[model samples]
Target chain A: MVHFLKHNYQDKDYFFLWDVESGSLHNMDSVAFLCAKKRYDKTLSPNEEIEYKKISSKDKDEINAFFNQMEESGSLNSPPRVTYFKKNPDIVKALCLNICHDCNMRCAYCFAKDGSYNTAKEYMTFEVAKKAVDFLIENSGERKNLEIDFFGGEPLLNLDVIKKTVEYAKKAAAARGKVFHFTTTTNCALLDKETADYLNREMVNIVLSLDGRKATHERVRKCLDKTVKYEDLLKKAVYIKEIRGDKSYYVRGTFTVKNLDFSKDIIALNDAGFDQISIEPVVLEESSPLAIRKEHIDEINKEYERFANIYLDRRKTSKWFNFFHFMVDLDFGPCVNKRLTGCGAGTEYLSVSPSGEIYPCHQFVGMEDFIIGDVFIGIKRPEIRKKFSEICVLTKEKCQNCFAKYYCGGGCIANAHKFGEGMDAIYELSCHMTKKRLELSLAIAGIEKLYSINA
Target chain B: HIVTLFKSSLDKNHKTGCGECQSQSCKIHKKM
Candidate 1:
């Protein structure tokens, strides 16, 4: 019933995003969710607002005139009446601190390096880290409950810095009558009794990546001697669960198509012990597109279907994923943010490097051109703000026309900036996949509820 | 020409290892 209702989005009229300046794209829906009392306010200049109201209230001819005037002025602020999703930012949402550009593991698909920082070697000094904490705590207003996530090459490696910052954050949030939670998604290469105990005491929710079993995991992730990094990962996963005793600490893996034929690893992780599972495809860069040929797509889709059947039917306490789990879990609706729901780049959240340089996300860290701001001045500077405004064009052309505009939110600014695709390119192959995934989720939910299969 | 420019900009703006969101897919996956 829970899964069915959560995935059931037929009732939601609009999508909402909150505190976009600090909100991470991942976990955004949960973070930005608000009481329906707040309504969306379209951002428009006074003249544009007047024209929109006039067109909305006047006859068709007047509406066309106003629209033409808007087009001439390039002031397309008011979108025609659409489904409304109320977004009330009454409390603090989520904070993604790119604490450092450092990581312990060297995942092959890492894009966070230029001539700069792709390695898990560098870090932010205590000074910069402390300053960032002070800034947040000092100015934090209406931030009722803040879920702080540590992001980096490996946030665990910089444990002291985060522990220090968290001390201040907890006190600040408490002083403001707010709550605090800590979470991290790591490769699980640095988990030991000491580190695990510290994390458990901090009440940190962990997501350890184990892309299936040994062979598949080793294909991309490796250590000094090309050793499979599975044993320690599983050991730590089980150990963390036992220590924390919190079923919410998610220990799962991502599955790329190369391992479509493998379910042993999924079983292995479950055996190692993790209850929550997040099985997603290897969403490669647009340039690469996950190496998915047409046949591969069809084959993987079928394989995922088979895999999902096992996952759904299994009576085990631990969760296991075949492939279709991610696709079958989301509620497809317009994002909820009125100012910017599409891309959290430049506007809401910015990914900062160890040196205080900023990028859109961890994926886009330290690329010089995409540096929206710096730690010295802050992200609200005119130059950075200008950079942000320039990139907020997802609603430009193709994205506005597509029905999935609300559903897909015109993806990232960096990837689709080319391909003759502004934020509004016609539904790409990926968008098609998202829509298909939504339908699958709806079907699974409908089945689970109507047939009482999950009961 | 466009691909070169795009790649150059990506290299300039986006460090690798960041999620290859490329565009809408990243936010789309998260949003939905």
Candidate 2:
């Protein structure tokens, strides 16, 4: 079948055709699009009657020429194929170390069971962290570049271990002729001058959590005792800005149902001198009060539209700002081509908990069933790896039929499990939101293209 | 071909990648 997807933006229709067997993208004209769509829908056959009731002879000839060209390119042929990745134990690329299970703040919609993962609040010892690093290096195969992310209830809570781990990883990488990149995700509540200086000197990529406005951010992300104010967090953000200047650091915000006009948050962050900002929907149980419902999707879509407008306006004025998700290569298609799953969780990416147990991603840190292995033994159950490796959009029945399957990558596995569904099951709200976001991104790209051509 | 043309335009405007230094260096640089 000739698999392709179509969308209408600003009264202009666009079609994206894909050669499933070759994984190559083909540009489709209106006639080619109709032909491909009808073929996929089984309403038209290759050698069947040309329905010329709606088309003139000229258009019909054009359609026939396009169809013949596509056929010659082997775009219409359905080649038998299977997508699978063989287990290569030595190809670890990225590892997220759950440095500290203890957290200083008690955010309202924290999925990590209030940051401790519902387990005892503790910090990962340097020994366990060192082992995790060693495990990464040993399994890193021929890969020279790797990444280690400092994650936790708040990674700063275990700054000592992080410092040691970075120091060790640097030497270990040098000795093995590998380059290791370090990153940390912090709530910014604990970013003091000393810590900021250390992060700056080490060149660690920092991802700070700051939900848009003070009122909205405080409503969801608050201190355990509700004493740490938004001003305090802002001070840390400014401090990091001062120390790191423009080094790569992202100001990430989570927007729950409580704050649907997330564009305001992006604006606030931009006004606050943060250039790289990303605001994401809070991932919560579908039944949770904070979960984005069907009714909220429309409002969220409007917010994205507003956000896109503001983003374009900034570009027009020569102002510098980047909305994280909006930073997509519309021309080049989805980032991963070989993977069936998004983010390569259990396979390429692994999160090590404070006690040394490993899970697919950071979201699965505390979940026992999701535990794939431990630091000492290394990937205890290869079966779990196989399961995750085998899972792709094709394996997902819903996603197989989704127009946004290639882009969405079957959604997040952690989210699917949160809705009490299998890995292949994506949350309906996420699916809708993602498809809308992709559409908006394409529209924005379209507008930008027009401007560039005029220039 | 349209996508490629669009991508070339975007690249000409320097609106490409994640807008970060791919080198992953420590030195502070202005946002592009």
Per-candidate Cα lDDT values, in order, are 0.48, 0.72
Stretches of candidate 2 off by over 4 Å are A1-90, A225-227, A242-246, A331-341, B1-32
Candidate 1 residue spans exceeding 4 A from truth: A1-94, A113-120, A138-141, A225-229, A262-267, A285-290, A293-295, A315-335, A338-343, A380-429, A453-455, B1-32
Question: DockQ, per-model, please?
Answer: 0.03, 0.07
Model 1, position A79, has a per-residue lDDT of 36
- Model 1 Cα lDDT, one tens digit per residue, A1-455: 00111222334222222111111111112212221111123344565455544432234444345435533432222233333322222111444567766555555555553213544457777677655555444334554445667877678778888888778778867777766777777777778788877778775567777766777777766654345356777777778777766434665565555676645566666655655656555544445633433456666556545554455556333353333344322222222342233444554344566776645555557556566556566554445434444443243554444333433444555545432254334325455555445434444444344335325
lDDT of 2: 0.72
Number of clashes in every candidate structure? Answer: 36, 1
TM-score of chain A of each: 0.67, 0.84
**CAPRI tier of model 2:** incorrect
